[model samples]
Target chain A: MPPPPLPIAPPDTDPPGIDQQTLLAALRARVARLEGAGREGHGAAPIPVCEGLGLSGGGLARAALHEILAAEPGCGAAFAAMLLGRAGGTVLWIGAGAEALTAWPPGLARFGLLPANLILLRAAQWSDALWAMEEALRCPAVAGVLLAPDWAGDPAAQALDLTASRRLQLAAEAGGGIGLLLRPDMAEPPPSVAASRWRIAAQNAAGAGQGIGDPCWRLELLRQRGGRPGGPWTVTWRAAAGQIDRESEALEAESA
Target chain B: MTAPRRYLALHLPAFATDRLRRAEPDLPQDVPLAIWASQGPRRLLSAVDLRAWAAGLRPGQALADAQAIAPDLLLRPADPEGDLRLLEGLALWARRYTPLAALDAPDGLLLDITGCDHLWGGEAALLAEAQERLWRAGFAVRGAVAGAAATAGALARAHGDGPVAPSGAEAEWVGPLSIAPALRLDPALLEQLGGLGLMTVADLLRLPRPGLARRFGVDLLDRLDALAGRRHAPLRPVLSPPDLGAARDLVEPIITRTAIDALLDRLLDQLCAKLRAAGRGARQVVLMAWRVDGAVQEVAIGTGTPLRAPAHLRHLFRDRLERLEPGLGFERMALEARVTEPMSGGLQSALAIGGRRDEAAAQLLAQLLDRLRQRVKVRRLAPRDGHWPERSVAALPLLAPMPEMPVGWVRPDAPVLLLRRPQPIEVVALLPDDPPALLRWRNRPHPVLRAEGPRRLEPEWWRGPGVARDYHQVALASGARLWLFRAGPPEAARWMLHGHLP
Candidate 1:
C-alpha cells in the first residue's frame, strides 16, 4: 500500500535534500523490488536463501539488521562491530526501568549484534529518561540508537515534537546514522517520523533440532516517505551465528 | 565536568562553633553566642554569632566590632575541610531520595530530581522531610525550588524572592530576575547588555536573536539555548552508581539449613534472571531471616566474584549459612544481592573448556583460602602485597579489606610462634651475627637455636616517627620458633617479636 502523502511546506528547491516524497519513493521502490522478485510471500515467512550459498537462516528483525549491514557494512562497521563486540558507546537504550535495559543486549546479540556501541543509561524515571534520550541524540559519533517507549505512555507533546526534530538533526549530523524507536505492543502501528518501521515478533519453525531459527518475526513495512508499505514478510534469524533467512508458507497463503 | 541544569544552593549560619563554645560551659541555647575562627589577631574569618546574626550582624566583621555590638561574641577558627566532609556525608544520605544529586558550589547541593518527586509523596513533602532532618541536626536552612540553576541560586540567596517555577519554565523564571555578579557572567557582556537598557534578564531576552548573537559571543547564546530548553543540559551527578538489588519472598517460613537451601535456590533463580535481563550479575548476597520471636537475623555473604548462576550462587550461600546461630523459629526468609558487574556469560566456563585444567583447579583451591578467611575472620586473604617479609599477607578483619601494606610477615617455611602484632622482646647477645645466646621472653631465658639475620631495615628517611629494625627468622632450641627483630637502626638495637607461623 502506498504511504499517505505527508503535508510538507512549499518547496525550497535548493538542490536535493530529504523530503517526504523522496522517502516515499524509496519505500515504494523497496516494496516493488521485494514483490518483483517473487519474494513477498517468502518475506512473511522467511525461507533459507541458501539454495546455492548454503547460508544459515533465522528470524526477520535479525535478518533486517544483518541485511542492512550486509548492504552497507562499511557505513556502520566501526559502530556495528563495537556494539556487537560489547564495547561501550553513547547510545541510550530507554525503557521503563531495569527490565527494558536488561532485555536489550541479548536480543541484539542474538542477531550477532553487540551493545559495545552503547552506554547503558538506565532511566528509572521518565523525565531523566527524556533527558538521557535527548542527550544521546545530540551527541555525534553515536552510531545507531535503540529506543524502548516509556511504559507510562507518550511523553509531553512538546518533548515528543522536540525528539522528532532531534531525529532529523541527528541524522544530519551523523550523515547516514539512524535511531530505532521500539514501540510497545501496539494494536495498530504508532505514528512516527522514522525513516522506516518494521514490526518484529517470534514465530514457530517447521524443522526439528534447528533451535527454532532466531524466533521468526513478521515485518510490516509501515511507513516510508517515497515508498509503499511492503506486504508483511516473515523473517527467520539464527541470532548467535548472526544468520537470517526468509521462508514462505504455502498453506498460510492459501488460507489467507 | 558535566554542569547541572539546576542548583539548590543552601546557606548555613556560621554559628557552628559558637554553639560548640556555648555548650562548653553548659552554654544556654537562648544566650546567642557567636563562634568565629581567626588567623589575624582581631579579624574573624568564619563566624557563628547567635546573638549578633540574630540581631542582624552578618559574618566577616572584625571581632572587636562584633564585641562592641554584642559583648559575648565567641570566636573559633573554621575548619572548611570538616564542613565540606559533613556536606559530602549529608549528600550520601540524600541519595535515598534521588540518584542524580550533585554537589553545589560550597555549602550547597543540586539534585536533578526530574521525576523522583513521588518517592517521598511529592517535592514539597520530600523537602519538608529533608528540612526536618537537618533542623534536628541543628542547622538553620532556607530552601527554594526553581527550574534553572541561575534562578535557583538567585532566588535562594534572596530568600524565596520568586515563586517556584515548574519544570520547563526556567526561561520565564530567569528572565524576570537580575543576573547577579556572583553568577560569574563576563563583565564585558554584562556591560554590553546593560548598555542596551537590559538590566534584567528579561530585557536581554527580548532583543532580536540575530542582534544578540552578533553582539554577544556564543556563550550567551549557549546559556540562552540551555535555559530556554532549546538544548538539554545534563547534570553530572556525584552519587554512587545504582545498586543491583534482588529479593525473595518464601511461601512458607523455614529455618533449617535444608529449608534455607531451598529458599536460596528460588531466590537465586529469580535474582539471576533479573541480572541477566539487565546484562549484569551480583557480587554480594544478604540473607535476612525473620524469626517468629520478633527478631530479624541478617547474614551477609559476599562473593569473591559476581555469580549469576542459580546453582553456583546457591553453593556460595550454602557455605555462609552453615555457621548462623538461628535463635528462634523463622517466619520469613529473603535473599538479596548488593553488588553486580556486567554480564560476561562465557568467561566462567572458558577455563574448563579451554584445557587449562590445572590453572582452573588452582583457582578453585585458592577459593578454599576464602572459606578459611570467613571461618577465621581474616578480612584480607591474599598473599602479602609487598616484598617486605613481615608485611606480606597480614591478616585484617574479615569485613575490612586492607588497602595498604601491613608492617609484619611470617616466613612460610619458618617454624615460629605467631602473634597478631609485634611486641618488644628482651635479648642478650654478644654480636649481631651470633644467635641470641640468651633471650628473655616473659622473664625466661631461652637457649639459642639457629638464627638468621641482622637483615637491617633502615628507618624511613622521608617520614616521621622513624623506627629502624634488624629482622631475624629464629628457631628456638626447644623447637618453638620465633620471628624476631631488633629495633633501632644497626648501631643501637633492641629485639622485638613481630609474628609467628601458623
Candidate 2:
C-alpha cells in the first residue's frame, strides 16, 4: 500500500510576496539551524543511500536518541548491527538477563562491526542496564550505545518513561554520540522522548533459490521528529559488500 | 680500596620478660621473673629478667633448681614464636636508622650501619640512641659496633656495653672475650675446651692453627674467621617497603564523610606525587583506615590500565568508600599502592592535536570502563580459533589488545544471538536425514518455511569423545529464524534450538 500524501498548505494561504516552496525551505533551514546548535562537531550520520533518500536530512541526527523495535522475535540484532556499523569510534553494547549473552562477535563481524571496537556490558538488572546506557552515551569516547533491555515477559518491569529517556537524550547530546534503544515490539511502548521510532521485522529474501541469502528486513518508520515517517520498505544487507541496499534495487541490478 | 663494612648488633637479653611486661603493664617490676621451656625430659629457664639475674637465677638452669635459688621467682611459659615476632618488629623499627636491617633470630637485630653512623653524629651516638630507645621501651638491650657482624654480635652478647671497635681492630677487640659465650660454641666442645684451659679467645689463638682446626672442627674456625673479618657474613634483610604510600594521623578522630574525603584527597595527592617521581602507575591500591577502638578497615580498587591520575582514582574509589565501617571514628588513614607497573609520562595539553585527541579518547574510554566495571561486568569479545559455535569467540579483558586475526580465514555464517545453553525442541522431518519441517520450542509449535542445512559439526577430538551434530537454519512461519541441531543417529536423535539468527 502507498503512504498517505503529506499535508500541504493551500496556495491561497501564502503571503503576498512568498511562494510555498520558499517558505518551506526557510522553515527547513530554521529547523536545521536549531537542531545543529545542540550538536556541534558531530553532524548527522548518513543512513545507507537507499534508505537515506526517504528521510528529510538524508541521515539520522547524531547525538540524539533513536528507538528501534523488533516486530518479530529475532530481527533486532541485525537491525542494530546495521545502524552501529555506520558509527565511528567505540560502541558500548548494554543488555540485561539472557538477552545479554546473545551478541556473538563473529556474527556482528559479518555486519562490519569489529569485535575490537565493541565493549559488551552485561548488566544484572534493568535499572543497571539503563544506568550503563546513560553512562556510555555520555562518554565522549563512545560513538554509539546499544541498550537492549529484556522487558518482554514481565509487565511489571519499569518501562523507560519519558523522564528517563529524556535524561538519556540530554546525555547523548552532551557526549555527541547516537543512542539506540532496542526493545521487543510492544503494544503501547509506554512513553519515550526519543527523536525517532522505528519497527522492523525479518523479510524473506526474494531471489535466493531454496536457501537463505543475505538478511532482509522490512523497516517501518513509525515516528520521526523532523523527517518524513514512512517505510515498511524491504531492505537487504549485503554482507560481502558491507552495505545495505533496497531489496527491489538489488533484484533489478542482479537481473540486469 | 673500599672502606671495611661496619655492622651494629643489638642483643635483647630479657626479651621474653620485656614483651610480657609491655603487654601487661601492671606486672610487678621488682619481682624476679623467668621464662621456662621444656627441653626433652626437663624444663629449663629460657630467659631471665634483671631481677632474676640479681637473685642468682640464670637461663639454662633447671626450673626446679632456679626455684630453690629464688623462692619468689615469677614463672611464665616461653613463647619462642612470639619472641621472634617481637624481634621482627624491632628489625622493622630499626629500618628508620638504616634501610638495611635483619632479624638476628631469638632476641637480636642486625643493622648494616656502614655509612649511616655519620647521619646520627657518630657510631657511639647511634648505638647510644638505639640502646636508650630500647631501654625506654622496657627492654634490657646491649649494643656494639664493629667491622664484622659476628664480632659485633659476640661483643654485644659477652661484653655487655662495649665501645665501638675501630675499623681493623676486630681481632684485638675480640681477643680478650671468653671463647664459650663469645663464639656461641657447642656445650660439649666448650667442656673439652674448658678442660684444656682454653677459656679466652686469645689462648685458642696462640695455639697452632692446623692443630686447633683438627681439634675443634671447621665450624669453630669459620666462626673465629668471621669474627676477625677474615670471612664475609651475609645478612638477609626484611622485605622492602611499599613503592608508594601515604598516611595521615588525625589529631581529632573523624567520622564524617566530608572530612574523610578531604583526608583521602590529600593522601592521593601525596601518593600520586610519589608515583610520578618513581615513573610508575598503580594497578591496585588499598585504603586502610585505623579506628580509635583498634579495629582496622580496608577497601581496595583495581584499574584495567596503569593509572596515576588522582582524580580518576578518586572517582573509582568514590562508591567503594561506603564499604568502610568507621566505628568509633578513624584515628588514622593510609593509602598504599599494593601493585604497581611501569608507565611512561605523557604530555597533557589543553588543545588536543589529531594524535593527542585519540590518546585522550582512549584514556576516557578506559576510565569509563573502570567506572562501569565497579557496578557490572564489562568485557570485550575476541575471536578464537575453533569450528564449534560456542568456542569460536572468547571474552577478553576490557583493555587487552586484540591480536591480528589469521588472514584468509572466513567467519562462519553463525547466528547473532547464541544461547548459552541450547533449549530442547521437538522436531518432525520428512526424511530421517533432512531438515526439520515442523518444530515445537518453548511449548509453541511453528511450521518451518525455508529450511536449510544439515551442516555437520564434528566434536573436537582433543576435547574428549562427543556425538556429531547436524545443524539446520530454519525460518519459522512467524518470521523468526532459529538455529537447530540434531545429535546422534536418526533412531535416537535428539533435537535442540541453539541460537536465533537474523
Candidate 3:
C-alpha cells in the first residue's frame, strides 16, 4: 500500500507536491475564499461542517473519491442517495423508462433514506428536465432536490440564477433534506452550481481477499466546495448494511 | 433552410370556460351574449361577451339586472376544469393546421402554419376555417392576422380585417382604429383622458402625445406609440415549433371495433416507437376516422401520464374507440400524440411504498370514472381529498388525474368519511365527558353499540366560527357506523352527522 499512487499533477506543478497536511491547508484556503464571496454579492456564512468531516489530499483522484462517497450513500441502491446525502437536498428520480423509483440502485433505504423526501419529476425532453428542476427548487417545502437525468440541462442564466438564489442547500440544512444528481456514467456532467463532484467505479478484490465480493471505488473527488479534498482512501464494501469503512490499517502501514 | 412562409394565430376568449357553459342552441347572430357564473345571481364569477362593441359591464354589474336587460342571454356555473380540457382538445385540433401549435392560455393558441397553411388554402382561409369550426361548436370568435403581433392585436380588437399592414401601409391600418383594452393601460390615464374629452380610440390618436406624457406619464405614450406602429413590440409566441408529425394513410377505413382497435394498436405502436426513438411521449392523442363521405370523425383523449408504453397507452383509448360513431364506411384513420415527455431507459427498481398504495390501479380507475363523468356530466364524479368529514371531496375534471397526497392525510384517530357539505343531525347525548348513548340521523334513532369519545376540534380561532366542532365515530348495534360531530364550543356541543364510515 505504498501510499497508493499520487495523481500526475500538471507539469511544473511543484513536483510531487507537499505532504497531505500542507496540501489540505492550501485547498481549505481556496474554498474559504470562494465561500466568503457568497452568491448574493454579500459575504456567505461560514461552512458549518463539524470538525470531524474528512478532507481530501492534494490529489484529484482523492478529491473525486471523497466527493462521490460523501454525496452518494447507498452504493447498491442509487448514486442519487449518495449525492443527496452530500448535497443535503431531496432527490427527484424521473424517466420514461421503467419505474423511476424502482430503478434506483440497491442499498439506498438500508442507509435510512426515505422515498417521500425524494421527489420523482417526469419530463419529455432535456429542456423539460431543466424547467422541472428549476421549478422544484423554488418550492421551499423540499429540503433539496436530487435531479436524476430527468432534471438536467443548460437553461437560461435567469432560470439557473433562480435556483441558485433559492439557497436550496440552506433549505435542506434547515429541513433535513438532501439533493442528489444521478446521471449517465458517460454523461458530461452538465454545468451546475453543485458543491462537489465524484466519478464512481466498481472495484474488484484481488489475491487473498478472494472470498470477499468486489468493493466499489468512488474514485476521487474531482472537485469539492468549501471543504479540502480528502486524500485517496479505499472504502471496503459491505452489502446488508451499506457502510464504507476506510482502510486505516492499510494507510498506517503504508505511511510507516 | 427556408424561413416559414405563413403562421396562423388562434384566439379563444380569456373567459372561454364561462362562454362554453352558456352556449345556447339559438341566439340571434351578432347579438351580445355574456356568460357569468351564478346560481340565482349573486356574484358574477366571470363574464364572456360575444361582441366586442361596448366597453361597459363594469366589475360591479348586478348579476340579476345584467340578465334582466339581456333576456336571451345564457348563464351557468364557471368550470375551470372543463375549460382546461377543452383547451387541450382545441390544441389537438390545431395540430391538423400544423404541429407547431402551442397553448397560449386557457383560451388562446398560436400555430405556425407556415408552409402548412396552403393545405387549408391561405392564412386568411385558415383563420376563417378555424372560426367556422368554433362557431359550429357554439363559440363567438373574433380573429385578425398581420406580420407583427402589435398590429394584429390592435386590428383584431377593432374588428379590422388583417393579414398584414400591406407593404408601406403599417400606419394607415393601425392609425385610424381606437385603442383596445388588452394594451392594459392604467385606469388613471383613461380617467384623465375622459376628463380631457378624449373618449374614443380615435380621440387618443389625435392628441399630442408630448403634452399627454407630461401630464400622465411615459406609459400611455409608449403604449400608443407601440400600437400606432411607431415603436417596436415583439410577440412572445408561447411555443417553439415542433417537427411535423408523421401519419400513414390506411388502405381503407375499417368500421368494426376489432379492426379499429387493431389499427389503433398499430398506429399507437408506430407513434410510440417514433416518440421513443426521439426520446419523447405525447400528452394529447388525436384519433381521426375518415368516413366514406369526406367528413372525418375525431375523438381526442388527453393523458395525465406521459407516453412511453404503447400497449398500456393503446388500452387508454380502447374505451374511447368503442364509444365513437363510425357513421358510413370508414376510409382512413390517423392517431397523433401531441404533448410529449422525455423518454429514456434506466435500471431503477420500483419506488419503495410505505404501505399498500394501489396508485396505478387507483389512477386507472379514476381515469375511467372521469371519462364516464365527462360523458354523462362533469358533476357526476367527485373525488375525496381530505380527512375532514365535510369538505373532503370535490368535483374534479374528467381528463385530469388526481395528484398523490404527499402524506396520506394525518387524520385524528377517528373513523368516518365526512360528507363534502355536512348535514345537520339530531342527537341525544349523555352529559359532558360521556359518550353519546343515542343518535338520530335522517329521522331515525340508533342505539350506540360502541360509543367513541369526542375528538375535540377547536375552530380556527383567527378565522371565524362555523368551523367549531367536536367529532366522534360511533358504531350502532345494527352493524351501522356513523361519523358524528357536534358543533359549537366544547362547553356547548350540538351534534351533527359529519360523515359516514364507508
Candidate 4:
C-alpha cells in the first residue's frame, strides 16, 4: 500500500534553518541588547512581539491578520485573548471548540480580556466562519475578530484557502477592524494574504506549576507586509495590571 | 369607537353524521342513517342525519332499538374529532372572505362579516354565496346573519335555512322562535314549561325575567338576554388573523417586471409607514399577488432581524419575486407583515440606533444576507447541566446571550466541530486504558503521534442508562487533532470519535 501525503508541509512547520536550542540562544542574546525598549515613555504600548516586530495596531496602513500558533491546547487561545484585550473594542470569537466552550470569563480574564464584551458565534463550516467575520467587520464597532474554524477539514474548510483570507483582509479594511487567527501548534495555515502573521507557542515561566503558566510565549513574526519580521522573542503578559512585559535576563543568561 | 360587528352563524345540527355522509357521497339519502358509539355498555346514537330525523331515528337511541324501529338504519360509529376538524377547516376557508372566523364546537362557525359582506354585494348575497358553496361541498348548513353573535347562532338553529334578522329587530325576530330550539332545557323543566303553556320565546320574554330565573336556572335569563341582544357574547375566534397587512388593486393587470416592482415598492412604503407608526418592525413579509385569472402567487421572505426600511425590505423580495409566475397578469398585490417586533423610538435612528455598534453590524449583516442565496440563521450553543461532554451543550437556531460557565467547568480540549453523531472506530491501543495509538476511521488509518490525558466525564446517570466516557485529545501523525472518547469504564471500553478541534 502507498502512503498518503503528510498533512504538514516541512518548510512551514519547522521554519527551516533554525533549531529550538539555536533559536532560544539567539532570542536571549538579542533580548539583552533591547530590554528597556518595551517600557517606553508611552506606558501601555503593545509588547513588541519580536526583534523589529510590533503588535498590529495604530496606523498599520491596513487591517490584517495576526496569526498565533500555540504549542499546547489552551496556549493559543490565551495568547490570542492577550492581543484581543488590547484591541480597544468589542471582540468576536468564532468557533472556539472546547468541552464546554473556550469563552470562560475567569479563564480569559487572567489573560486580560473581558469575556462579557466577547460574543461567540459557531459555524460548522470554515467558510461560514469567514462569512460571519466579514459581516461583523463591516461595522467599525468591532475593534477585532478572532476566528477558530470549527470544522476539522472538509470541503467546508477548503473554502478557506488564500482567497478566504484575502476576503477577510478586505472586510477588515472597510470596517477598520483587526483579525487574529489561532491555529494548532503543528497545524499549517494555507497561503493567506494576511497583512501580518506571527507564530506563538507557550513557554512555562521559571516556576509554572499547579495551574497553567502565567501567559509566557515564544513568538515568531513570520510575515509583516511593509516592515521586516525577524526571529522569535520571549513575551510575558502580566495579569495584575493587565499588561505585556518583555523578559531579557533569562535570554541573556542562556546566551552566556 | 370600534365599528359595529355583524356576525353570520353557520350551524350544522347533525354535524357528526353529516360529515360522515359527505365523506362517503354514495350513501343513499333515502336511508335513515345515525352515528352510534358504545358508551359503557350499549351503543347510543350520537348524531342523526336529516333522513333519520324524518324516519323517527334520534340521538341517544340504542342502535338495536333504532334498527328495530327503522329495520334498515345505517349505523356508523360517531367521530366527533372528524366533525370538529371539518368544521374548523371550513372556518379557516372562510378567512378568504373575512379575517375573523371562529369554530363553534361540535358543528358551527361564527363569521364576523362586518365590513366584508359589502365586497360580495351585500349581507344577503354574501350569505347566499357561502350557502351555495357549502351545499356544493356536501354540507347541510343553516346560515343566519344578525347584528349580535348569539342572536345569529340562535336564529340559524331555529330556522333551518337562510334568515337575516335586522339589527334593531333582534328581539322581535327571536320572539316567535320555539323555546325547544331557542333554549334547550332539561326534560323536567321543559315539561314544566309545556305545562305552563309557554312554547315560544315570546312567552318566556312576556313572563317576568326575575321570575323565570327563580323557576329555571339563572343561565336561562343570560341565554334569553343574549338572544334579545341585551347581553353580548364575545366571539372567540381560533386566531383573529389581523388586518395588519396591506393590499392594492392595480389599475391595469400588471404583466411586466417593472409594473410589479413598482407596485411592490408602493405597497411596502405604505405598509411600513403604518407599521412604524405602530412602533413595530416586521420579521416576515409575505407578498401575495392575485392574478387576473384568479390564481394567487405568493412570495414570503424571512429575516434574522426585524426590518422596516422599504428599500432594504424590497431587496429581500427581489429573488423570490422573479420566481413568481405572472401567469396571465396580476390584478392586485397584498403585502402582509405577519411577525413583528416593537421598534423603540419609532423608526430606527440613522446613526447608532440602539447606541451600540452591534446594531450597526446587525444591519450590515442584512445586506450580505440579501446577496447570499443560503438560508441564513444564527446558531446558538448553550451549556446544558450535565457531566458528559457530548451531553453538556445543546444547539438552538437562535443567538441567545451565553451565561457564564459554571465555576468549576473544565475539560481537555474538545472539538469545535462535532459530527452529527459519534463515529465508532477500529482501534489498536498500546495500553488497555490509554487512547488508541492507531485507529481506522472512514477507511483510513490515522496513527497517533502524541495524546493528552484521559479526561473522565461521567455520564449523567440520573437521566438514563448511560456509559461513562474517557475522552482524549489525540493528534494523529496526519496532523489531525480529534477528541476521541472510550465508552464504558477502562475495564471494558470501546473507542468512538466525537469532536474535532481547530
User: What is every candidate's C-alpha DockQ against the true complex, given to 2 decimals?
Assistant: 0.00, 0.35, 0.01, 0.05
TM-score of each: 0.38, 0.66, 0.38, 0.58
What is the iRMSD of the candidate numbered 1?
Answer: 27.2
Tell me what TM-score chain B of candidate 1 gets against the true chain B.
0.51
B1-502 per-residue lDDT for model 2 (tens digits): 7778889999988889999888778888888989999999999998899899999987899999999999989899998888887777778667656657898777888899988899789999999988987887688899999988888998999888756998788889989999976888878999999999888987877888889899889898898888877787788887454567888778899998998999999999999999999988888887878666444677888887878899999999998999888877887788889788888884222211112257778788888887898887788877778767887777776676775555532354578777778878899888889889898866888888888898898988999998898989988777688888999876999998888788
Candidate 3: segments with Cα more than 4 A from true spot: A1-256, B1-95, B99-146, B149-267, B283-305, B322-339, B346-413, B416-423, B430-433, B449-452, B455-483, B490-492, B498-502
Question: Sorted by TM-score, highest first, which candidate order results?
Answer: 2, 4, 1, 3
Runs in model 2 with CA error above 4 Å?
A1-15, A28-38, A47-49, A98-100, A151-155, A206-208, A248-256, B1-243, B347-357, B407-412
Reference contact recovery of candidate 4: 0.03
Q: lDDT tens digits, residues A20-45, model 2? A: 88998889778867855335566555
How would you encode candidate 3's per-residue C-alpha lDDT over A1-256 as one tens digit per residue?
5697778767875557588889877777677556531232212222222122253322111001112322222232333343343333233443322222222211233233333333334444544444444434433333345444311232222132335424544433333333345443434444454555655543333233222233334344555766545444445444344445555646524632
For each model in turn, which proportion of the native inter-chain contacts is also found? 0.00, 0.68, 0.00, 0.03
Per-residue lDDT over A157-188 for candidate 4, one digit per residue giving the tens place of the 0 to 100 score: 33457777777776776666678777654555
lDDT (Cα, 0-100) at A105 in candidate 1: 33
Model 3, position B244, has a per-residue lDDT of 18
Task: List where candidate 4 sits over 4 angstroms from the true fold.
Answer: A1-76, A83-203, A208-213, A217-235, A240-256, B1-3, B12-38, B41-99, B129-140, B178-200, B240-243, B248-266, B276-307, B315-502
Each model's lDDT: 0.48, 0.80, 0.49, 0.68
User: lDDT tens digits, residues A1-256, model 1?
Assistant: 9999999887766346778888876676676465332222312333222222222122121112111111111112212322323312223344434332122232233233332223333455555454444444433333334444433345342234535534443442332223444443455443544444444433334443421122333434554433444535555444345444455656335422
Give each candidate's interface RMSD in Å. 27.2, 3.3, 20.4, 7.4
When summed lDDT is taken over every stretch of 10 residues in candidate 2 chain A, the lowest stretch is: A44-53
Candidate 1 off by > 4 Å:
A1-256, B1-35, B43-56, B63-90, B118-141, B146-151, B159-162, B166-172, B175-238, B245-338, B342-413, B416-441, B449-502
Model 2's TM-score against the true structure: 0.66
